[model samples]
Target: MVRRRLGDAGPGGRGAGRSGGGYDEAQAQAGAVLRGERKPTNPLTAGQVHVAFKCHNGKHIKAESNEELRASSSVIKEPEKFEVEHSGSESIYLKSHTGKYLTVDKNGDVHASGVSASDGSVFQVLLQENGLVALRSHCGFVAAEANGRIRANRSLIGSWELFQVKDRSRRSRTEHPGHELPEPDEQDDAPAFFDAFCQVEGILTAEERYAKTHHDRTAVLFDKRVRSRRRDHMEWSFKHFYMEKEYPPSFRGCVSAWDITRVEMDADGESDTPKAEDTEDAVRPRTRSGSDGSQVVSFDGLEAGRCHWKKILQEDLTDAVRIIAAFGVPAASAADADEAAWQRLLAAQAGCKQKTAHVLVMCSSGLCKAIGPIGVDCSPWPPALDAVFAERFAGLGAGSIRLKFGALPGEAYDVDKDPVFLAWKRAAGPTARGEDWVLQHADSRLAEFEAARSDYERRRLSEQVSTAKKQLEMAREHGLPVILQLPAQDDAERCMAELLVAVFGEASQHPILLSGFNGRPKCAAAFLRSFPGMMVGFNGLLTHSKHKQSLGEVAFDVPLDRFVLESLGPQYPPADSAAGSARGSYSHPAHVLLVAEELARVKQRLPRDILRAAFSNTAKLFNLSI
Candidate 1:
């Protein structure tokens, strides 16, 4: 059973007389503190506040996933933060960042394991004259050991019992009546609430904030590998993404294993199905020789679109061993490298003297690869066959895989509309090795679509319309959210609305993400009308002066909860120049912060509030642990 640390001054204290009958006076003193009749010498007050504890030895106390409390980590990650809630008088409840409350076990070991405040969850704060505090339990005073574990079996106060608490109340998400001003000596990771937003302050402020706090932050990579190994090993790593342009070491986020499908237009500007070689059947032949010597074609419905699954699986298994070898984790065979296995590896890694834990995987999208393959090339196959394949894949993932539907932007055009793309298509003839041509006309491609305004309006709307309908149908059938990136065309909205209504019924609650929205305000509201749970995504376009007012209008009209922030990465840098950002200056992860600050300026809300809400919305959509 869980235990709390209420000592002689608790409810039991009302009856137990000790220390020359000071119980009544102690009770009265605690009451005074709770009622604001008296202030404790320490900074803590009656209300709840976010806080971090620094031990006498100067190490910060961190909450481990295993529930044990330890004072070992020097850097303050999310787990290190705690919410201190006033229970009564001098008694308080400490909750970990993950929502678990600190509890004392029967054996006196303190763990952040309480689901809710109950018997071993409460503790009385003993504010000391030295501006430090100690917690007392019925068993003994709480203490931090030099070995990094926390326990409450100490009978008397000692150096290990005292902890210097710093108020991090500004970061709290609870509804406090008021917040105390931060100390002047407190580190300014970004502009304080007092500072107003300005153009000059956006990116620079974000860069400074990233340098100070997020240097060790976890980042999500989409089918990309880290460029270089850090001095400290990562929790995980995999070979993923573009061979030359990989993520920087400072990149912090989650990892995704992505099966890629490139959308290409024919010379006459028609959507072409991916070549047979790009299909799953082409990569791994479906026919197998039976014992009777006849050829048999396997009809496994679950393996649709996943032509490269075996290859991916083999590489991932090999990479698991590579990570273990590189990080000096306990040896393990490739056979034991699933999610739980990876967690065990990390647990062992954390047990060592390493400063950081890294878990790397080379994939696009998020965890669990049972979703098979994802793409828009199910054509030439029967509708019934496609549906069965999609359903089987969806069932295997069990909601782990999300449907990502990317629509053409407003300026999107057929290759026939651009001489360069058209010429490239003619020369390449829908081949796989045409990326060089794409690189050559990168800037002019989107611009030329605007030049063929009439053609773009008609073609872009119909471009992926059929495939989108099919994807949405699959998503609706499986109750999976669709991360839909809409084209910039206004008709694209109408087209999507019609498709959504047709697929999921009118005004369905199907979760959808409208990513990189560069469209009109009317279209956004109309699209929202069709799917209420849809969220609009704003990318680096938020930082552009030309798109400022229009996007800002959309931001204003839409409910604040229905918006999310994104960065186009290096593709859409703040610099207006189409070329030459100079070597080593193309990194743009910090630009996400600039997007947040700009959105805050448009909404006239606190940057932190906007950032917090945006992050929460994203986490909810992605089902990520924040």
Candidate 2:
């Protein structure tokens, strides 16, 4: 029910009229110039004269021997002249001295052909500030030259569309009162190409050419100003520069968190001491003097290994200040280095003047690697370590002890293929307690297996169901908060649901943490609904991609309690000393500092109770307390 505007120009002037039926403002201005109502401000005289259209590439549009116009670099002494006559419409027709009108054929080629005005012969002239003009044909093709040949085919106005219209009638300038021509300077005649071209053939110097090529003057000036300010800020003396020692000097007197698992091997070539299980009364603390005169404390019962904590403390920390010493123990091991490390840490905690520092011992089933492939090796923790630490730490009189257990593959029920299942099977043997436990929970699946169609399929399904039940029982025995490292795959949602069902029977609201999920909304949302207290860990590298404008600019609509920043070490490239040599190699100090700064900025928007940062062994080597 709407009427179309007759004067509206279609895109690219597809169906526009030659005069004014559907001409835009630019075309209307061109019409006025062509009709002589408005004279061009350029010095070019309006009269019949031999004119040459020069392109930025030093080529001139000239009529060939066959009367076809082509762009040529070769200079010609005399060219055919044409009469500039207005067509009384939105364009002008060029009449050659030989009396043929300049027209375009069906192929968009320029040549003097028809004796009368036609749509193909009509051209709208656009004037530029640099005394250059562009001719657009009625069919919306701008006259342009490519590879030294003139063609009416370009659809956009660019460097190639510009042409230098020179008046060839310089000898008759005195006869025309208003057309006073000035002497031409070589530099003034240079065309503004402003892009890379055949520079060797051009007359401009490198500096002059660069100025024209970089047309954005404001950007260039701003960059120079920034560099100048940066130079002023970098005026530092020799005292400001210091080499990085093995440990920062400032940390010598300050209370610092140390991961004993990262301590280097002693001069005696022993990486770990003899297993603590071999000796009775292992809870007694023993001290030995190192070659550097520092006292090394070792504990057998708590599995805390040798630590140099005493040498590093100038004065005991205040009662309110606590230094955390954290390490993890695997489930299958009767003796583990992390266990010895924790015992040593706790023994040291008992001797301190103030009960300020504490020890955090993480115990996990030897299934860390079975969950999925990760950049770093996932150390396994013995299930016994969880029970032992949970029972022992309850009565510690010194600094408190925090116990954490790693959850076995919550839903990795592929019995034959899953490492956790295979390990449990081997440990339990044919007549072990695990076999009885598996049968008790997998009765329904075992009944189905007895009536399955294929023997191979039945065996696989039966083993998987058995493994699922065994894993569920393992989760129940811990009776503590568990960390669930989910597989890094798109189907994590289904895996999570299956794991929850296997562990809790239905969906008991037990506190669980899910790791290894990329910060995708759908994956996060799936965990949010099913597990109310579920903590989802995302790779810290996601911050780089999500907020490109600045560091710490990322925001998520998900609750803070459900979000966790994890895998800080693997995100950084290895130190230059071991570049490309290992996956999850040690991180450089600068890399850790950069991540710490970013996390500090991002933490402002997160909830106070949110579990802020998680680190790998390599990242743990860096000072994370800052």
Candidate 3:
């Protein structure tokens, strides 16, 4: 019943909605431009254009290094660009800037790993009345999750599934001519490198010629801006001083160190591609492989001649400490000295929470005399306290801290006045440890419930109180220091903290430590206010590429005396770091040092100073002798 037009040939036509069209109209126009046959003056509106998909939430669809397509909320000005290659009137293939095609998996996950456009990569573009578009794969509609993940799993279209197609070619066509725009692979051409280098070279004086030479060798930029614009080094005034010729933002914070061994890169060639055997200890440039057999390079934060403080470059602090302990080997065999560093880091992370009848603290002695010890176990839960609390205070009061826990038949006790409760209270007092008692949470279940506080919230609270009471009893019985090991999540553990304050009274000092804190800036201030005498623990999690920027912000406010180091297991390790061959051969207790060094790197302090302060805090907390 449909009338046919010159261009309107249904699904098989080039421009189904317009007159005078061909399926290869877009391809022909692109080819003509590449062949220097014509100018792309308003080419985007004429046919298929390179575009970027911006979700309603303002995030842009990006291709991760693993080729997984996700919605990224990064603050960078540029998002990943994709070219629209039309298959039919309604179907198209989204080709990434790297030449790979976006394909949908059997599970409906989108990935930019396909080399050529195939049936899996063909997506039907459904235009909506609101000017947005929905991409339909074989399985379902492509959806953008609130967490910045992209998938094609939903059968129905929703707000999350709709994306605003941004014409990247539109801006380029009008403002920048085709020849004027640099090719993607030529972003870091010689002219750009020289421009950046000359700016640094102009600031150097005759006396600083050595620094100038060093800068020339190591100061290479793979991209225009720093890898992480928010990196601590980027914020350093010295960086601004050298690059922008400006004074530091503050004079008091401007401390400098020379004779530091920087992370060395082989300056043999202009290529910035990373070597095959780059070790974890090296601060070399990072590289990603492109689908077209080219490499894209980036620097994580190592820019030379910025006057960085002494970093633990050759060996992690723990490895260096261990090497010094082995009677000090010559520089030749030093590489073999700290072979077990990786194992130690693994052990420290895996055994972070050691369940034992007693808590023990060990101290290390060597060249780095204060390199803190491993195997500091928090006291385990006692069976007796559970029995006692169930018998005395479980079900007597309504919000009474009694009825919520549900006690046995006809059981009640004045918890404040009870002999057992009073005894535990005495043992929990600051005077028991000759300094201050700590109350740590050992339960992992509370964090799950913290996300959703249901009818069982009161029950969980009562249970936490009983555990704290029991832990105090055990610490008192064995003459152990009661350090409050709180969960990294503040909301769930905040209740436990408030309960302790309510029961024990905030007047008594209880030193607290967040065991697995991942250096979230929002959670840092809240933790400081909620727990008295609180200390933040720096762990391996903070060393991740994603958390690199946040770590500096979190570490800036923490007092040197109030921060401790932990080798907590990494929640997400990179693909290479997780390989069985790369397991224990990598960072060890040095993992703790790496965290400290990162803190120090951000705070602009010497690595040794950070290590000493952390070790001192550790010793004071556990009441251990140096």
Task: Identify the runs in model 1 with alpha carbons over 4 angstroms from their true place.
Answer: 1-259, 262-463, 575-588
Between candidates 1 and 3, the lDDT winner: 1
Write model 3 residue lDDT over 512-552, tens digit each, in one string.
Answer: 44444552454554545444555666665555666555554
- Residue 3, candidate 2: Cα error in Å is 56
User: Candidate 2, residues 10-58: lDDT per residue as tens digits?
Assistant: 3222212335432243335544656667645642335534565666543
Error (Å) of candidate 3 at residue 445 is 25
Show the lowest summed lDDT stretch of 10 residues, model 3: 189-198
Q: Put down candidate 1 lDDT per residue, 331-450, tens digits, no spaces.
A: 111111234333423332233334333222222212321111111211221122234234333221101111110112222344433434444566777664556766766556444333
Which ranking of candidates, highest TM-score first? 1, 3, 2
Model 3 residue 583 distance off true place after TM-score fit, in angstroms: 5.5
Q: List TM-score per model, in order.
A: 0.36, 0.26, 0.27
- Measured with C-alpha atoms, the lDDT of residue 5 in candidate 1 is 15
Models, CA RMSD each: 23.6, 27.3, 26.9
